[model samples]
Target: MPYYCDLGPGQKVYLDNPGPTTLITLASGSAGQQQQSSTQIHTGPWTEVPQIARVGSGALLRCVTAQGTYTWQIQGMQIGAAPTNAWVADQATPMQATEVGLSSMASMQPMAPMEPMAPMRMGDMQMSMNPMTMRMGNMTLGLDAPAASTQQFCTQCGAAIAWGDRFCGSCGHQLHQP
Candidate 1:
């Protein structure tokens, strides 16, 4: 899924630590608004750092990050708050630090409730709903793939299922009969 940033009126935007290219798909200011073309040689970051964007009104600025992507929103109208510059290069929150592997799940929503697993025997292993993985008490196990790689997985919970089985014993998801 793509990330979205909703900015209020007069709230400017900026790129903190960007990747190779932060493509601004939607700026939401003018119908004739065109993305400026540029080619610069930089030695520090991947793409570019400290990219500023003006937000006259409310808008959803959509951009893609390749390596280190951190889009920061600052109060442009307020002077005492911070710099008037749209984008700041340093950092904001600890979550924005791309070094900790948080950029991928920064805008993630809550996961759906998983169905309780029923007692089913699969090679003497207590299989759970997670795909190719099982949780026994607190320890988790990662199942190895077959040499032929003919393992069938449940569509709902990603648990390994028998090829001849109709319903997923882990999540009770119905499988199409072949």
Candidate 2:
């Protein structure tokens, strides 16, 4: 059996599959615009469908089962204001630190001033500084300059391709100028 329901914008539907294996498919959008379809297999008792958002009023949900009839339920309903408990709010209020019988002796005492240390000589410490330099023929080996490149990513699969590569290595899609 198959079931259909119209869902509003920013609304989500939940299906309760207490029976055997069930296949669920969702379709949404208008005729001119591209319609999206998502299919999933549910073996658990409860499964939530993907959130659907339509511009005007064109959101539909379809659920079908092969073994037996399935049940469907809708979630994310706009209900009224939630009920409040006065006793819970009063108990949730935090008590003061003094009222809780917690006292910090360090906070009550004045902090001592820190003294400056004397500068030690290089000989006093067992460390030494050395300047290093490397020259590859006439050019100096340094990371000051950036490397030149014309690398680009493929539009189809987003794989890293060289500046003038013809095809993508990962997805094997052709790259051409139109």
Candidate 3:
């Protein structure tokens, strides 16, 4: 997908699964607060303008970026680490039926759009021990992070596995699979 921007206030951007899920709005703030900034989501070649409003870092915002990646920018996080840009360089590599859990024979279709105005909950503040501050566009709902286990690829058999597996079913390699 080509790059684009989210130019509207309150507008949301959704990304394909396996990519970032949200983008929050941000604007000028007092001391220690960030300066007024615009949030944009670029998808393929279209740049969307968002509705206008003052928003903070911690608020959950959602939008897909110009790189064909989805992102979730929480109000409190830095723009560089915005989930959308996290793997911006990591474009979708077609995975084998076994690699992506998708069969080659199956028809590939985009998923249905999620319900608009869906209620979203961030991480558990108590367990995460994070702060509880809200900002405009405070909630971004469509982002999905891959499980930790999905990040690993078996060195011996070239298969992906949970962090530690004792054995590789594909190549019969030994692993401590987490």
RMSD of 2: 29.2
Q: What TM-score does candidate 1 get on C-alpha atoms?
A: 0.19
* Alpha-carbon lDDT of model 1: 0.40
- Every candidate's lDDT: 0.40, 0.36, 0.36
Residue 78 of model 3: what lDDT? 39
Q: Quantify how close model 3 is to the true structure by its C-alpha RMSD in Å.
A: 23.2
lDDT of 1 by residue, 109-135 (tens): 355476677645555556744345775
Worst 10 residues of 2 by lDDT: 97-106
lDDT tens readout by residue for model 3, 11-102: 22222222332222233344454344333333443233321212432322333346553434434323433453343223322211113322
**Which scores higher on lDDT, 1 or 3?**
1
- My TM-score estimates for the predictions, one after another, are 0.19, 0.20, 0.20
lDDT of 3 at 125: 20
* lDDT preference between candidates 1 and 2, better one: 1
Write the residue-wise lDDT of candidate 2 on 48-161 in tens digits. Answer: 332222222332222323432223222233211122221222222121112211111112344446554343234323221222223444544344433344457899998887
Measured by lDDT, the strongest candidate is 1
lDDT of 3: 0.36
